[model samples]
Target: MESDLSTSDYLDQIERLPTHEREGQLFWKLRIRETRSQLRHLFANSRLRTSLVISLSIVFWIGLFVLFYLGFDFVVGQVGLPGATYHAQTVQFVFTLFFMSLQIMLIFSSGIILYGGLYASNETNHLLTLPIRDSRIVLYRFQESLFFSSWGFFLLASPMLIAYGIVVSAPWYYYAYLPGLMISFAYIPCTIGAIICLILISRVPHLRRIVVGIIALLIVVVAYTSIWRTLDIKDADLLGAAWFKQTFRRFEFTREEWLPSTWLSNGLLEAAREETFDPGDLPWFESGKYLIVLLSNAMFFHVILLWVGGLLYRSSYYGLNSRQARQTHLRMAWIDRITEKLLWLLPRETQLLIIKDFRMFRRDPVQWSQFLIFFGLLMLYFANIDRFRQHRQDINVLAWVNIVSFLNLAVVGLILSTFTTRFIYPLISLEGRRFWILGRLPIERDAILWGKFLFAASGSWLPCAILVVSSDIMLRVSIQVIVIHQFICLMLCIGLSGMAVGLGAIMPDFREQSPSKIAAGFGGTLNLVLSAIFILLTVLLTALPCHFYFMANESKLQTQMIPAGNLLLWLSLGLIGVVLLTALVTIVPLMGGFRAFRKLEV
Candidate 1:
């Protein structure tokens, strides 16, 4: 009988054809095939189809890099002194602390990625059933996580490093050393993260919640510590000496001898400051120590990870696949009761949809953890407003207060936009392959869209309003300013939520399972771009009136030329324009979303 095996089957047979080919060669072959398949699918459209898309993407990335480079260059120039290495040290300290903090965050995030099925793709699942060693599987997943997590670091750090190099006039070897350092730095996190995930899977599955809670506690502790350190209210004996001492002490912690950040910083700075470039007299032994430390540590941890995986992979994989009852049922029941009481007034269908959305959000630790981190960081920054005021005495205090409040509005609006893009924009698309079940229900698509909007808006609005009101209170701004900012935040909430929902519905992607992937598609890109533009315009509209008022007030006091009545007339017209713009932004996108969702073929 003729063989009826498919190509994949034939490949498998060929793989088993040689016993020596089962380990490294087999893994590479599978990986190569998988990568090529993805690439082909990604570029399946005709050449003309995505030309505009490609052009826009290139422009966006180039603009981002240019913006960062310019910003870093400006910082270096401003901070550089005529006869000192002060600017270089400052930059090194900042980079070290930043990378250290990022490493900590990556450890927690990696555990979540593994536990939450973020890497549980169809290909990975299929690979698990094959004859490949579990160590190879772990290695593949580690590489995937590392690649996904490192891009942001590369984009952010490259410009700063390049700017630092330019500021220091470093040699070519200094530039060459940077990529190796970065790669090693990236490897440390991936190795540590993989180990964390494996340990959690093998030892304590139920401890994930506790780990997240501990991370939250750590954030709170750090926030409190920062506030305490920065908000010293003791009256200083007014002398130039005290101010100089305080300024010098600001970064004392960065000089600690024990930190990896310190090592990395010192290494980079030493390499950059090398005065000789002659091949015979290179500072190999001295400058090379940091690189060796970084590389050895990375290799050490990665080897340990592989060894641990080889021992624990089978049990952990089995445990990870097993279905265990979640322990939060009682807490969820209590929340459901509260939700029921709150939504008793809504229609039954809407109530059910809202409840479902809440349950889904609550069950997903990856989603909620991210929400916590993003907003928690914002809150921490907001909590430091009093400290900001104490330090910024050069400008008119009230003028500074108003400026910060207005800028706070923009920042909070931008946060809302990001939240909507990351979470809300993916909701409709996240229905995924089971969307047909919704079609079978007796509910209207409008109800579904409305529920998502209301839920997302209300969720986003509370935090944003708190941020606005708390900052205003901290700054002791006038009640008028407080109320105005609150109003603007409310309008922003509606507009952002509406735009995300509408754009998501219009360009739903049910094929992609990951929220991050879904949000990186064309619709998500457009939503982000439009949302950013909307925020800019809104800020300008609101700020224009305030700017006019401030200018008019200053001129009235200084020159007595501009009349108060003229100022009032301009202010009234500006307020009217703002109100109209807010209404249009709030309403149009929501209606568009509803209509688009209704027309969607289930």
Candidate 2:
């Protein structure tokens, strides 16, 4: 620890400190102590019973694990697929890829979060005025950040491991599972923390977002390729002997070269086959590949921690302390000025809301990241649709595709509603004491709702509709299907946007205006569930017509169930859909918003 501290001072050039620098150092130490005190107070607070909630949550999660374990155990026992001759090598390969990919993603996500502006705020500015060693403060905060990030990683990985163990039904010595899993999970927080630290230390800070994005994309691709045999395009050309060699290629790779996922998988397999793996036959198993992988991962994390202690602490501290360059000009071009003038047609209040939503969106990196995620999902769906095409015989694949496409659009609409809500949901709440100021004004409640709804519709639902349309066209979907799908999707967007407005109005909570809290709150959950139910109902209605169309086509138009009556019934369903959509988009939300405003505290 002393050597590390000395090395850090030398590397950071902190020893040649001026008089003011020494004073600033003392101030920073005090700030660190104060921040630690705040953390302690938060933990001790009666209102924040985090431990109790966490314990209960863990117990509930364990119950889920038990259920998964029992189910997998039954399936494996009944199928007997784990038998020596039963080689699910492809599945194993895919599983290994997915496992390693998840580990990478978790690490990457943690890195971004740790590097992000979690502590780079006015609060941190004040904290920098204390007396502690800069390295000590950084270490403490890094550990705190890890504590927050690690729970999510554990939740994601543990159930899958438990399910696998149940399926493998390995013997008693498999109790070595706890240590192995722990070692595997260590990289997530460690690597993330290290990456974040390094990025901070490096003055080229703008590259951080790009680096995080690349890591995320790489992980996504790795996972996808691992899970889908079709994605393993290179392997497709391999012949019988080549395929066998590919399966046993682990022997050719060194322990360092192998991914933690690969090692964990190999370890699990070896442990499962301890009863059968003969050293003379399979030297790979006897080579202790798994243990080596685990150790390497653990050691790598420690190296990262050391780097954080040395380079990161001072760099991050300075970065947090510095003032960012501010825009000097409030000037606009002729086109921009014209656009603003056109936008000014809306009432000043409504325009304000629109501007606010746009500003909030522009300020958030997380919101922008959703575009990447949606793009990925779109690609995956396109791939699956192509796969489905290989199986489409006599079916008007267009009709079915429309159903699936609109269903996908429906999900997009719902997410858009949710995403936009994160910004606008807190708008009324952010008004705080100014609520009375608004209430005292001549503005009607309905007008306020209308203003909010219009802003949201323009920003959220409208853009989602455009994106879906663009994607549909890009896929070269049939024109007729696109027209219908677009119509249905537009209707869905209206409904979801309206739902969001209503929910925000109804469940207004100024005190809990944080986006994350809003997402987790009962209001948000309720809106999500309702949106899902509506989407489900729409799917059922649309699917019935699709099913009838497919069945009629397949049967050579002989005894069609979709006759005149059924056709009328379908049209009637469409009419009902319109009415329900109107209700969802306009009436329910209006009423909800009105009620919420009436109950809203001034």
Candidate 3:
């Protein structure tokens, strides 16, 4: 009997040992192989070699740096009066506040990313089944999340930081310090984001709806406060002016002074100033105090992550996984009934397909929530047009209005491109292994393709049109300009939607389950690059004629080179060219996509 007990104990001990001890090494090796495979595949394509891709990426980044530098130089030249050196401090403070707000945004965005798929990935589930320690898995995921979230911030900040250095003419050491500051600054947000995600996943698995509601309320509150503070218009009398003065003078306390972003900004600004001004009394590295603060805080947060990860990672992961088992049925029967009633005019298949897409979109909290946050913020900004008009009365109101109206077209185009790439581009790819079901259906490939295009175009058009028309109305532009701008926006929407759907179909990644992962692939990159190029060309074509007309009216030399009649003819030709370009961009990709889909054996 004692020997039997010992044998059973030995067996249990063996079972407790890790199933795949070399899994960590295996994971990295697979990653390397996948990267190499992608590179080989990219180079295999005749149109896009590895060298060409690298060259273009480098050129694009350099162009961005140069453009931002020039813009900064122009702004500083305009605003940097000799006696206004005190304004430098104000600039630093404002930038500090901006970075702090961005960090807060990052925290929420990271939590969403974690909840969306990172923690609940297939690999993570597999890992949990092994005998490996849970802390290691948490650590690995945290590292990956940090890298993914921080790299974009680093790329964006690089140009702006370099531009600041050039503007200040800082010394070499200041340039050296800039990268360290950015790195440490990035780490703070990443750590905070991880902690927030961990807490939410562990403590409140069903918190998404509550959090989204809170965010919506906060957005409304912010919009209301901004309008209240800025809309202090009154009668042109003594009481009115006094009321405005008093409102403007009301003091408020803020926590910006203690924020890490403030520390980073102060450190960088001080270092730059010292390099330029030669403040001899201060010791070397005295300006390094804020840098020290940033680094120390980053390190402290990282240590906290390790501690929490070691303690709660296993239990939290179990909680998270268990919560996934409790499925909630969506009460979308009303939606189906309404759709059936409303779409009686259309064919059954088309109506069913549309309804399916709508239900899929509505069911995915991650997808629709992101959509709400992005467009909601835009709507909030648009809602404050009255304040913008009130504050900018010192300028030529008509010209300002016209300029804003023209710029609004570009902004709307960009927003549409983003929406298409994020949502529309992943539609076909997201069908996954179930695509065979679609193939067996009686629906034609062209019908499916056109449905996606039409849906995407119509979905994007309403918001774009509303924002554009509202801005135009606020600007009080002429009826002719409003009609022209609205037409341009419509064309942009159609073209962007077509490009996104076609490119998505051509390079559908059926293997990846996550939409974000699919969108991060090569096809998505190409879609974005093409969309940007198209937007640029469209804007240039439309804006040039407007510029000529505006110049002809504003300047006295208009009659010499071109008469108003000739200018109108030129403008008409330009509009025609724009229409042709938009049509071509919209049609070619869709045709290619249809052919690609038809050729697929599945």
Candidate 4:
């Protein structure tokens, strides 16, 4: 370390230097150069990773766009009267719901992300040592938090809006305004989250988490009550006008002019509705009005964020660090005891490793909070799933019930895939810098991979199993279907966990400290793509035989007799195929990861 006198002399010399306004410009200019350098490395050094990620992303995007196009076409051409007012209203209503849901998700996720970055990261400490203003640093980090939280928002939102544009035959201006509108709309929730994060940390350091919990609870209450009311339909009303009315009414609040989602949805729909291709058409004014509203709000929020950050950022940093330094004891919970008891069959080292991973997740609110928000939404929907069911023995209805059950299983599996991708895939990569400690331990390197796999599998299984059971119970499916769903859930947990852990070992990013960045890399993208392919196959195989069985059993007048033996044989074959797929998915990855772990240099 340099002597205090020398450090003081250097600091005094630095203070005497004049600050140029363009120094801030210089920072961003350097940032762009660094980004270009990284992109060049991605293209030049990692061509395979680049190609695979791009191809997979395009496939995913095109698939979603096609689904939206078909749905919109059906609603317009097949549903209700051909030229009816209902078509436009229905499209606008859906747009409102889509943007509104994304708004709530962005705000919640942004808060969690900001907390992890602003308070928890060591990088923030390093940034504070530079000559930059605290507000400037906060703004830089805010952009990161926004991007991290909203990439999924962009991916899901853009396709739907673009598909709607095609269906409506909108003017090119609609597509032109889309990127700007989305950016402005997304900025609102993220700004709100940032403001809340700063105030909570700076003013009430002790009550920050409690405040966050209260906010989350409020959001949950609102979401649950609103959705529950919409879903509280009688079985007799299935596919009837009454069910549609209630559902639409529940989401009607989304159209309130005060809401930013309403602004975006209205802007897109209005612009999409314009038939004229003229560059300066009078019809453009309607959409342009909402666009102006969105932009003005974004600019206003931008000013407020900088002001708030300037006021609170530095103090919040110090106060937060001071508070953490004084806090030491971590009391063990009953959950830990139960976890140990449940894993008694595992070796001591493996058990300890699992326990360590469990604690880390528990300590990180960003991880568990997201888990609860997403899975909790599913849990809510599953509990209320009976609304879509009808007791009538109509063959179509019964067939739909079976189809939906299989779809529910698919949904749960897809979500678990994302969970594993986001959190589990980073496990080995996170350990890269710290492998020396494990190297000195008595445990073999292979145990590290196994421990992560087991933790991912068991931890994901419980909630997913509950979700599947609840969905089946509410749908009133037969016990056989429920058993099948449970089996599929187990298979998904094992396969996804194995894929994430294995690929994580194979292509670990030891140098990148951020988990979000790690998960966004090539390996995580591959794991996600593989998981999706696995789910598609599993659902197709299982749903086909079950659909046939349901159709044969539920029909009032049987046109063709179907043998129980044949149905059983088909179902058995599907399950056998699924089992083999799951085994290959789980085993191949784990074995590969173990081999890689053994040969790892660090």
> TM-score for every candidate vs. truth?
0.82, 0.66, 0.84, 0.91
Candidate 3 per-residue lDDT, tens place, 1-602, comes to 99999999988976776554465676667668977987776778734533543555566567778887886677568557212564354446446655766676667655555554445578777777866655566666766566555655665567777886787566677787887788888788878877776776678766756766577568666745754554555543222555544443431112256777777777776666543255664422745777788899999998887677767777777775667565566665787778667768777777777778877877666666666766666666666665556656644665666677778778778877867887889898876357789888998877777778877876688888988888777766778788888888888999999999988888787766666656655676567667877887887786778756765666544576678778778778878888999989888999889999888664
Model 4 lDDT-worst window of ten = 78-87
Residue 579 of model 1 has an lDDT of: 69
Shift of residue 565 alpha carbon in model 2, Å: 2.7
Which candidate achieves the best TM-score against the true structure? 4
Stretches off by above 4 angstroms in model 3 are: 1-37, 44-56, 78-84, 223-255, 275-284, 307-332, 336-347, 391-395, 547-561
Q: Report clash pairs, candidate 3.
A: none
RMSD of each: 5.8, 8.1, 4.9, 3.9
By TM-score, is 2 or 4 better?
Answer: 4
Off by over 4 Å in 4: 1-21, 78-84, 234-236, 275-281, 324-333, 390-393, 550-563
Model 3 lDDT vs. the true structure? 0.70
Instruction: Assess each prediction's global lDDT (C-alpha) against the native.
Output: 0.71, 0.57, 0.70, 0.83
Once fitted onto the true fold, the runs of candidate 1 whose alpha carbons sit more than 4 angstroms away are 1-83, 118-123, 233-260, 274-289, 320-334, 340-346, 391-395, 520-526, 548-602
- What TM-score number comes out for model 3? 0.84
> What is the C-alpha lDDT profile of model 2 across 217-312, one tens digit per residue?
774575365435432325333334554455446433322344666666666556554354644744234325566668777767656665655565
Task: Please provide, for model 1 over 1-602, each residue's C-alpha lDDT reduced to its tens digit, 9 standing for 90 to 100.
Answer: 23655776878865674353457687678779987875676578434424544665566566666776676667657766212456655566567667777766666655555443323566667777777666777876776667656655676677667766776577677787888878887778777878877876678656665766677667767756755664553554222446435544764675676555666676677667755566665543555788888889888998898898778877876776685865664344778778877888989888878888888888776677777776777677777777767666664766777888889889888877877887899999877366789999999878898889888877788889998898888887777778778877887888888789877876688766667656656667667767877887777776767655765565455446656676667667766666677667667877777777777765
Question: What does candidate 1 score in Cα RMSD to the true structure?
Answer: 5.8
